[model samples]
Every structure is written in C-alpha cells, then in structure tokens.
Target: MAVKSKSVASKIVLTALVLVAIFPIFWVFLNSFKQLVDIVSTTPKFIFTPTLDNYIYVLGRDNVQHGLFNSIIIAGLSVLIGAVLGIPAAYAVARYPNRFSDDIQFFVLSLRFLPPVAVAIPLIAIWLDLGLYDTRTALVITYTLLTMSTIIWLAIPAFSRVPREIEEAAIVDGYGPYAVFFKVALPVAAKSLIGAVIFSFILVWNEFLIALMLTTSDAKTLPIIASEFTLLGRNVPWGILNASVIVLSLPPLIFVGVMSGFINSALKKKD
Candidate 1:
C-alpha cells in the first residue's frame, strides 16, 4: 500500500511539473492566434474569435523572411562544421588518454563557462579587423566556437560509452583506424552524436547576444528580428510578437520531432 501510494504521489508531482513547464508555451501559442485587443485585455478572454492576422503580419515582413533564412544558414553550417571537427577530437579524447587530453577537455569546457559578452567583445574586434562584420559568414564562424565546444563535450561521453572490443574486432578484420571509426565506433555512437549535433544546432539557432552584437542587417537572426518587434514603443504588438515567437520555435521542434525516430531506433538497438 505504501509503495502504491508513493507511486501515485510521484506521478502527481511529475504531472504538475510537466504542466508548469508547458503552460508558458501553451499561453504563447494561444495568444498567437488572438486579436491584438484580445491579447492585451486584462480579463484574459478564454473564448474569442481567432484570426490569422498575427501570423500574416509577422511573416509578411521582408526582414523576418531574411532573418529566418540567415538563422537556418548560420546554425546549420556551424553545427556541420563543428561536428566534423569536434567528433574526431572527441573520439581521440575518448580512445587515447594522453597527458594533454584532460587539459584539452577542460579547456573546451572553460570556453562554455565564459560569459558570452567576454567572448563576443574580442570576436567583434577581430571580425571588424577582417572586414567580416555583419555577414552570415562571420556569424557561422563565430557560432562554430559554441557548437564545437558543445559537440566535443557531449560526444566525449558518447564515444567513451562505445565498446572497445567492437573496435578491436574491426582492427583484427584488417580495418584501418579511420575505417574502424567510421564503420564501428561511429555507427555505435550515432544516436548520441545526433543529439550533440541537434543541441549545437539549437544553441546557435536561439543565440541572441553574439548575433545581436555582430550583426546589423545582413546577418540578423530570427531572435534578433523577434526583439525588433518590441521597438514599437508603448503599444507593443503582443499578438504579432507571440506569433513571431511561435515561428521562431518551429524549426528546432520539427528537427527534434523528426530525429526522435532515429533516437528510438538507437535505443531499441541498445536494448
């Protein structure tokens, strides 16, 4: 009876926590469909006529479209570049424990720990010096630092969890180092690696500080454009802003939803 009681209580707690976490997102989603007056109403009308005007207004802007495109390009390229560089480095750190490996891992982690402003200040100067400021190329390269560190940190454990015996067996079958990594270790760690890449993608996608500091027009991201909605002074377009927020959130959510199948299959394999 006590165990059953405990289970019920735990489930109740988890349900409450889930509701708490999702309530803000649900609220925003609801408001996105509302008229501006409905959204700003103090009474918080639960029943109102829904309109597509908010989405229409938000999406019709050229800047919003360009910012969306820039976000996709920058995040995708940064994650791709980071995965190519960091995966190999992670494999090395996991498989070969040299004297410097720990130091290298620590250094990578320390980069993540530093405040964004600290890193952005120096990068701003460097990009300006190279005449690369306010360019998508600059954002991609700058975001690579964030993505690479994330990939290396997360992928180290994934690679470490891969069985060494499988790698050794591949070696016995006359596989070269590169071949073993590509065929054996990589396949085994594909699930976790995908997660690392997705996380890196999301990090770069939602990143506002560095993007704000570095970009003016050509390289502005979705988050930057979202913030621009607030510059309308006192009568902030709450419905339109919420609509933009929903749009900003769609890509990562879709990416995760798509990749969920792969993650499930990986789990089934491990089981």
Candidate 2:
C-alpha cells in the first residue's frame, strides 16, 4: 500500500509540473486567436468568437516577412557551415589526443561561457572595420561562433561513442583516416549528430542580442522584429504580439516535428 501511494504521489507531481510548463504556451496560443477587447477583458472569455485578423495583420507586414526570411537563411547557413567545420574538428579531438587537445577543447567550450554582449562589442568594431556591418554575411559569420562551439562540444561525445574497433576494421579494408571518418565513424554517429545540428539550429535561430547589435535593417531577424511590438507604449497590441510570438515559434516547432523520427532513434540508440 505504501509503494502504491508513493507511485500515485510521484505521478501527481509529474502531471502538475507538466501542466505548469505548458500553461504559458497554451495561454499565448489561446490569446493569439482573440481580439484586442477579448484579450484584455477583466474576465477571461473562454468561448469568445475566434478571428484570423491577428495572424493576417502580423503576416501582412513586409518587415516581418523579411525578418522571417533572414532568420531562416542565417540559422540554416550557420548550422550547415558549423557542422562542416566542427564535426571534423570534433573527430580529430576525440580520435587524436595530445597534450594540447584538452586545452583546445576547453578553449572552444570557453567561447560559449562568455556573455553575448562581451563577444558582440568587440565583433561590432571588427565588422565595421571590415565593412560587413548590417549584412547577412556578417550575421552568418558571427553566428558561427555560437553554432560551431555548440556543435563541437556536443559532437565530441557523439564521435567518441563511435567504436574504435569499427574504425580499425575500416582501416583493414583499405580505408584511410579520412575514408574511415567518412564511411565508418560518420554513418555510425549520424543520428546523434542530427540531434546536435537541431540544437545548434534552435540556438542560432532564437539568438537576439548579438543580432540586434550587429544588424540595422537588411539583416534584422524575427526576434528583433518581435521585439519591436513591445516598444509600442500604451496600445501594446497584445493580440498582434501574441500572434507574432506564434509566428516566431512555428519554425523551430516544425523543424523538431519533422526531425522527430531521427530524434527518437537517437534517444533509443543512446538507451
């Protein structure tokens, strides 16, 4: 009886935690469909008429569309470039351990520890000198610092998990170091690498501070555009703001949903 009671209590705690976590997102989602009056009403309206005006208003703007496109381009390119560079670097660190290897890994990890403002301040001057300011190219290059560090840090363990024996077997079959990495280690670690890429993508996608400092107009991201809504003093446009929140959230949600199968496989493999 005591064991059963404990199990029930644990389940109750877990369910409560889940509800608490989900409630804010659910509240925003609910409000996105509401009109201004319904959203700000003293009493919550549970059964008010829903409208697509919020969505239409938010999506109709040209800046929102451009910001969305810039976000996609910047996030996608950063992840792609970071993966190409960081994966090989990770494999090298995992497979080839020297006196400096640990130091190198730590240095890479240390980049992530620095606050965004610290990195952005110096980068802003450097970018200005190079005449790359307010360009997507500038953002992509800057964002690689974020994406590459994350990928390398996460992928080191993933690459380490590739069996040494399999690599040796590939060598016996006439595979060179590069071939072994490409053929044996990479294929084995693909699922875990997918997880790492997804994480890096989300990180770069949601990044706002550095982006805000670097870009003025042509390279503004969705988060930057969403922030503009909050600057409206009295009116606030809660409905449009909530609508923008939903819009901002959709890409990451869709990316995760599309990659759910690989994510599940990766988890199962880890298990």
Candidate 3:
C-alpha cells in the first residue's frame, strides 16, 4: 500500500511539473490566434474567434522571412566551421595526453565558462574596426567561439571512449593516421559528434545578444526581428508578439523532433 501510494504521489508530482513547463507555451499558442483587442483584455477570454491576421502581418511586414533566412545561414555556417575545427582538436586532446594538450583543453573549456557580456564590448569594437559587423560571415565566425567550445568539450569524451586498439589495428592494416581517424575513430564517435553539432546549431539558432549587438539590418536574425515588434512605443503588440514567438519557436521544435531518431540511435548503439 505504501509503495502504491508513493508511486501515485510521484506521478502527481511529475504531471504537475509537466503542466508548469507546458502552460506558457500553451498560453502563447492560444494568444497567437487571438485578435489584438482580445489579447489585451483585462480578463483573459477562454473562447474567441481565431484569426490568421497576426501571422499574416508577421510574415508580410518587416521582412521577417529574410531574417529567418539569415538565421539559417549564420547558424549553419557557424556549426559547420566549429565542427571542422573542434573535431580534430578534440581527437588530439583525447588521444594524446601531454602538458600542452591538457593546457589547450583547459583553455577551450574555460572560454565556454566565461560570460559573453564580459567580452561583448571589446568584441563588438573589434568587429566595427575590422568592418565585419552586420555581416553573416562575422556572425558565423563570432559564434564559433561558443560552438567550438561545445564541440571540443563534447567530442573529447566521445573520442576518448573510442577503442585505441581499433585505431592501432587500422594503422597496422596500412591505413595512415588521417585515414584511421576519418574511417575508424570517427565512425565510432559519429553519434556523439552529431549530437554536439546538432546541439551547437540549436544554441546558435536561438542566440540573441551577439546577434543583436553585431547585426543591425542586413544580417539581423529571427530573435532580433522578434524583439523589433515592440519598438512601436507605448502599446505592445501582443498579437504580433505572440505570432512571432510561435514562428520563432517552430524551427527548433521541428529540429528536435527530427533529431529524436538520431539521438535514439546513438543511445541504442551505446547500450
């Protein structure tokens, strides 16, 4: 009886936690379909006529479609560059343990721990001086600081778990160092590497501060564009704001759904 009671209480607690997490998203989704007047009402209306006007305005006005495109370009390129640089560095750190290797690994991990605001001032100044501000390339390169750190840290453990014997055997079988790394070690660590890349892409996709500071118009990302909806002084456009939130949230939601299979496969392989 006690075990059953405990189990029931645990389930109640879990359900409560889930509702707390989901209520905000549910509220936003509901508001996204409401009219401006309906949204701003003192007493919230449970039942109302839904309209597509908010979404229409969000899509049609302010070149939001362009901002979405810029977000994709910046995030994709940043993760790609970060993965390329971080993978080899991680492999080296994992495979070869020396004073220099340990130091390099520590430095990389330390950068991730540092707050972005600490460096944002000087970083923006340098970007302005170098004429790289407000460019996609600049965002991609700047974002690598965090993305590279993520990949290096995550990929290190993945590479470390790969059997050294497998690498040596591949080397003995007439495979060069590069070939062994690309074929043997990489395949074994591919799942973890993919996870690192996917997570970094998601992180960069939702990034606001650096994107806001470094970009103004030409390269403004979706998050920045979402914040722009409130620039119209006194009255906050709740409908449009909700609509933008819904739109901004869709890509990440879709990505997580799509990547569910990949993550599951990685887990299955480990088991």
Q: Which numbered prediction scores highest in TM-score against the true structure?
A: 2
TM per prediction: 0.89, 0.90, 0.87
lDDT of 1: 0.91
Model 3: runs farther than 4 Å from truth?
1-6, 41-47, 257-271
The clash numbers for all candidates, in the given order, read 0, 0, 0
For model 2, how does the per-residue alpha-carbon lDDT over 108-202 read when each residue is reduced to its tens digit? Answer: 99998899999889988999999998999999999998999999998988888888999999899899999999989999999888888898999
Error of 3 at 27 (Å): 1.7
* Per-residue alpha-carbon lDDT of candidate 1 for residues 122-232, written as tens digits (9 for 90 to 100): 989999999999999999998999999999998998898898999999999999999999999999999889888997888899899999999988899999999999886
Is 2 or 3 the stronger prediction by TM-score?
2
Misplaced by over 4 Å in model 2 are 1-11, 255-271
**TM-score-best of 1 and 3:** 1
Q: Write the per-residue lDDT of candidate 3 for residues 77-104, one digit (tens) a residue.
A: 8899999999999998898788798788
